[model samples]
Target chain A: MTIDWNAFTPWSALAGGALIGLASALLLLANGRIAGISGILGGLLARQAGETSWRLAFTVGLLAIPSLWLLFAQLPPIHIEAGYPVLVAAGLLVGIGTRYGSGCTSGHGVCGLSRLSPRSLVATLCFMGAGFATVFAVRHLLGA
Target chain B: MNKTTITAFAAGLVFGLGLLLSGMANPEKVLAFLDLAGNWDPSLALVMAGAIAVGLPVFTWAKGRQKSLLDEPLKIPTSNDIDRPLVVGSLLFGAGWGLAGFCPGPAVVATGAGELKAVVFTLAMLVGMTAFQALQRQPQPA
Candidate 1:
């Protein structure tokens, strides 16, 4: 019930979100593709000719941007309380789930919702509900 | 590189920067937002709202176009039916997100920062994705 006002950074968050939206908009306007991280990454695995280049280019950009940002600003400190086993399990779940679900937060939550896609809405709700339930179970019931 | 490739690269760069600036690259920030029972941070809500606000109009414009600016056919998904795979997959993805507080985009961006945990998580996620692909190739029991 308590809000962490001290940790809250709405301005930056909003700015970043706007940047994300801008990125998606640009991609759609330029390439007509959804900025879905999973779909982009998954396509790389397929190794389809003519498709691999752009995916690789996009991923390389994703990897390179943060490194580039370090020159201008200090990257935020990362904190992960979960152990390696839990992290691996969670990673696996996310990978499989995003593939099966057809998209993740970016594709479904941002782009899909923006386009008013009902499937994206359902997918977003399910994932968000699951996130809430999982957090509640882990933090409250299991005390982990 | 071609214009399409250049565009993809630019989009990825912007997206990565957005993720970093939004505090999403920090797992603690994400976990705090998800921790509705404990100390919840609503910053992510603002992030989503801001993204949607800008995206809505753009998508509206894009919907009417048959082709991108690059002259390629627009490939937007048209399926609206909420199927079992969609629900189950989203549920599982949400659980993983809650458990680790690192979705695919942030995880990849974090890996770029040379975080060992992100490296491990990314590897595991690739393994999981590969496994899903293998599963899809198997024949269903009749």
Candidate 2:
């Protein structure tokens, strides 16, 4: 197996990852909340009074990123390999799946692993395995 | 906004920026990492490790606390079950992630950037989420 040297970015990845960790840590320390994007979004739909405002604010802050980032530099490139059909199907699966599973990459992968929750570990393994298999099937078998 | 609200906003901003800086916002980078059988990019591994390294200690400390520094209830997840829902749901989520490299975080970030593709994906994701909400309210078949 060949490593994609040109695509590999260790420093930025680590630094960015640390920033994500800091965000999660900050949320926990200050608001007593987990920085799970799916959970945050899901909570928005439930419409619980006294809970809606903070969740809305957090979402607004996320929406504010592009404007904020554009102030200093150009926004990063976002390459989408999938077409609309795939995107729609994928989006549906992701939404339903994360909610049903109770977490996603951020929840299960980053925060859950950090806390060393065995359940998160199991969730992580299942998702990662499925992801690897899906990619293999798509790239190698379907030849997409 | 209260202290909690402000901090949550700040945290979201930081998280969004981290996705941008760490290459997580870039679907190509994520796809490259996921493309295991191909020329694999191992950078995402370091990303996960770096996040966990910083997060582990903070979580461990938070676990012992009942209240946050801002006087809010510490809301760490308490569920320990590794059940059918978790496995099935995660597998479905993983397949979707593999099909399209956009996860919720980066998709929202990109949608904020006015990317049309992200717009489509996010809308569909919301619809799917709404469907889940509807399905959840249904009477269970015995």
Candidate 3:
């Protein structure tokens, strides 16, 4: 598949990042929540009283965002390098990891770290380091 | 909704918009960048830079304030110790990312990006998350 490198726009990334920062900031200003996915999903799973509504709403919005995008622009193509089995296994592993880690990237990297959480600092570094190592191993070492 | 939930929803919305604007929502673009041996796309780096640029200032502003706008104090994770769970979780997350070009945010965005596969991947992701919770809740042999 051919890609148009020259057409790549940094502004999109800037706008995207700005949007995230704004949303997170606004949420904090308006609601005082950290916007962590693990906590939200975990809350839903544990069925904590009175937590279900918001969790469901959050999950719904998560699903809705992409659908809204489709109205204006064409969605990109998807090519999974791994097979179904690998993908499923990978998903399970991530799910377990989030439970053990206490938060996902957004929770740690975006909200927690922004708030100066030491635990998030450690978690973020660990995950990012592991990510770099994994990419190296998969694409370089294993050649998979 | 409680403060936390409201914050999460708002954050998700902004995050979704960011992913869409940045092209991070598109898994194909991510894969192409990962296809560094062939045609490398460095656009994600710019996204990271932009996030850091914006994030740093906002955090600084928040810090200067006496208290968080939403509560008495900011909630920060206190633990700094690196433990087994930390190591394992990072490894697992990394492996998943390596196998799938998209992470949670991108995957969520991709669903809106119009890829049925992303929708499938996301549903599978949710199932995987739920299944893990179930397993953890099961009684262990003592």
Choose the strongest candidate by lDDT. Answer: 1
| Deviating ranges (above 4 Å) for candidate 1 | none
Model no. 1, DockQ: 0.86
Candidate structures ordered by lDDT, highest first: 1, 2, 3
lDDT of 1 by residue, A85-132 (tens): 999999999999999999999999999999999999999999888888
Residue lDDT tens for model 3, A1-144 = 345588467778677767766766765555445556666766777897855765666656666776776788855444556666766666666667767777766777777666676777787777666655666677678876
- Residue A55, candidate 3: Cα error in Å is 3.1
A3-70: candidate 2 lDDT, tens digit per residue: 99998899999999998899889988998888888888888987878777778877887888989999
Query: Lowest lDDT 10-mer window, candidate 2 chain B?
Result: B1-10
DockQ of each: 0.86, 0.86, 0.44
Worst 10 residues of 2 chain A by lDDT: A46-55
For model 2, residues B11-79, the per-residue Cα lDDT tens digits are 889988989989998888888898899999999888888889889999999999999999988989999
Quote the positional error of residue B81 for candidate 3 in Å: 3.2
Q: Which clashing pairs does model 3 show? A: A16-B18, A33-B4, A66-B112, A67-B112, A75-B113
Q: Chain A TM-score, candidate 3?
A: 0.86
Better of 1 and 3 by DockQ: 1
Give the alpha carbon lDDT tens digit for every residue of B1-142 in model 1: 7999999999999999999999888888888888899999989988888899999999998888899999977889989788999999999999999999999999999999888899898888888888898899799989
